[model samples]
Target: MKKIAAFLLSIGPGLFCIGYTVGTGSVTSMAKAGSQYGSQLLWVLALSCIFSWALMEAYGRYAVVTGRTAVNSFKTELKFGKVLAVVLIVGIVIGQWNSLSGIVGLSANALYEIARLFLPGLPAESYWAVLSIAVVILAILYFLLIVGKYSFFEKILILFVTIMGVSFLISMFIVLPPPGEIAMGFIPSIPEGEGGSLLVAAFVGTTMAAPTFVVRPLLMQGKGWAREHTSLQSRDALSSALLMFVISASIMVTAMGALYYKGLTINKVIDMVYTLEPVAGKFAVALFMTGALSAGLSSVFPILMVAPLLISDYKNGELDLKSKLFKRLTAVACVVGLSVPILGANPIAAQIATQVANVFVLPLVIGGIIYMVNRKAVMGEHRAGWLLNTGLVLAFIFSCVISVIGFTALKDFF
Candidate 1:
């Protein structure tokens, strides 16, 4: 137990990355893809993980070498640096906060589902009940943010990520897809349908997340790592990306085995619960919901922190958790996160839409990081190599294509 705890503590930033990327957004997008198209979109998930690793390595390397965060690097390193930094900060905060709404809403709904199983007295679908749950969850999380330090956040995230990973993995084994179908998912081909493009965009957006990379430096700085730790940083990035792929792929496979073979789809959070209960039994449903709720709560911590983190990064590269600005911004984020439950929006749809919206900002983020990492003035002797640069270029191009597809999909949504 001590060894396990020590191992988890050593991978703090990697756990944070996992906590942020493999949250409710990833769960919804991956699950939807699996239910609607089987494992056809697994290609996107694979590619996104690869690019995510490259970008994280680049971002972390920059921080270790220069002791700078993304926005701080953007503000000081490139042309129109200040303008670009502000735009990046604004775009990421807006998108992440929007995602937080869905995160908390879906979390509340999941908790309500679990509550129903136990109490059997609660109304079948009570908006007020869900809202009340959301209030309680957010209140507790805000209190944690107010009092907890970075290491505290890291330890909590490690626990959540462990639970989430274990739950999903166990659930997937119970409803394992056929080996042949899983293998075919590796071959690249888009599913032909109305929402296919949007799901594709959301998958990439949720996995190869801009904020995940943009916030890497701040996280690394908070961990007190430096140039001497470059190798450790690389390993952390690889492990984070690899864990993301495994956990996300497990979710898709679980949906594929449980829903796709039966010609069903997930239209709501409750649908996941209702559909899985009979198919995989109450034990499986419990595991799935536990994972989903854990994913949502793990994400909420980072989502609430992003705005204040970015603002602090923009001002200077340090993250002051106790600052007045940090407290105020996080409070605002918590309130914004309540919007979905308050207004009674569809949490699933809100999650997917927020993810699709995230695609639009990726090109800028990829381009900015690419510029910063390649600059000798900034990175000194440790500038990015040709291989890393090539990956970044590919990631940038991919982001552009997905952004256009995302825009088209949003138009259809309206």
Candidate 2:
């Protein structure tokens, strides 16, 4: 019992980050994955899991060892380095612009589904954006300015969402993928078709380049995680990051295997709630919706956190645990996060832009990560190992190659 308790405690950071990983994008992307490629890209998920774990640990360790966030570290670099940081902030904003819209839009879709049960015409397209933005601001106020401490609040939300997510994961098992098909997911393969390629870019963009990954290590630093750093803690951080990947993959698989595999793709996430009922029967979708909601709310806390972090970094100094700038930044972040959907915004546009922002910003974050990880001075004794380096190189190369492919594929769209 004690061992189990210790294990669970150790898993908290990873689990918390993992909860956020199962957001609307993961759900939708997985649904897309299952529908188009039909488990062919299952291998991509596997490779991503490995890559996410390695990168998170390496990046987080850089922050921990050097006492610098990725943003600040970039700022500290030489003149061209600052240019890199500028590019990073700008690009991430673009990539996340689409993704941020997507998250709110997906939440609105889920809410629309939930509301259809009680009041058929309650939600409009504009309302979702407003509500999402409102919720983000309110959540920020609650944590940042009002309560002043978010540890307990964050923990509870993560726990609740993780439980909600796990319910969906279990249902996927009950849906019973063929052992052979399931095993085949472990093998790497891309799906055939142009749409498949777009979906793949979106899927990869949804989780990997998303702002959430950039913030996880920051969260770790804020939590005083490095003060007591250990190999065990290092492993724990890796576990947390991979756990993020695992839960994300689980949601995708659940949507893909149970929903998408059945030709049940919808334009938005709420469609799953509608379609899941007819195909997977009853409880499975309820579990899925609960998971989706959990995913949405888990993000609320972090979206709130980003504003202040950016502000403090912008102020060009150490983060004072207690300061007005902290409060202001926190408040501003929440507002910015929530401001998008004011007075009712377009749900679909919001949804698509949410990840588009991430795509735009990804190059900088990726560049920062690669540069830092390779700088042995920053990482110290716990610097990138051969295995992590290999994975980083591979992921970096893959991302670059895919950028070319993605550009080629979507050239006409642009």
Q: TM-scores across all candidates?
A: 0.98, 0.82
Q: For candidate 2, lDDT tens digit of each residue in 5-56?
A: 4575655556555544556666666665665455677676666566667666
Compared with the true structure, all predictions reach lDDT values of: 0.91, 0.59
lDDT of 1 by residue, 1-414 (tens): 999888778779988998889999999999999999999999999999999999999999999998888898789878999999898888888889889999999999999998886677978899899999999999999999988489989988998999999999999999998899998999999889788988998998799888999999999998999999999999999989999999999999999999999999998998888889888998899899999999999999888999989999989788779999989999999999999999999999999999998888899999998888988977887999999999999999998998999999988977
Per candidate, the number of residue pairs that clash is: 0, 34
After TM-score superposition, the amount by which residue 268's alpha carbon in candidate 1 deviates from its true location, in angstroms, is 1.0
Model 1 clash number: 0
Measured over all alpha carbons after superposition, the RMSD of each candidate to the real structure, in angstroms, is: 1.0, 3.7
Cα RMSD, model 2: 3.7
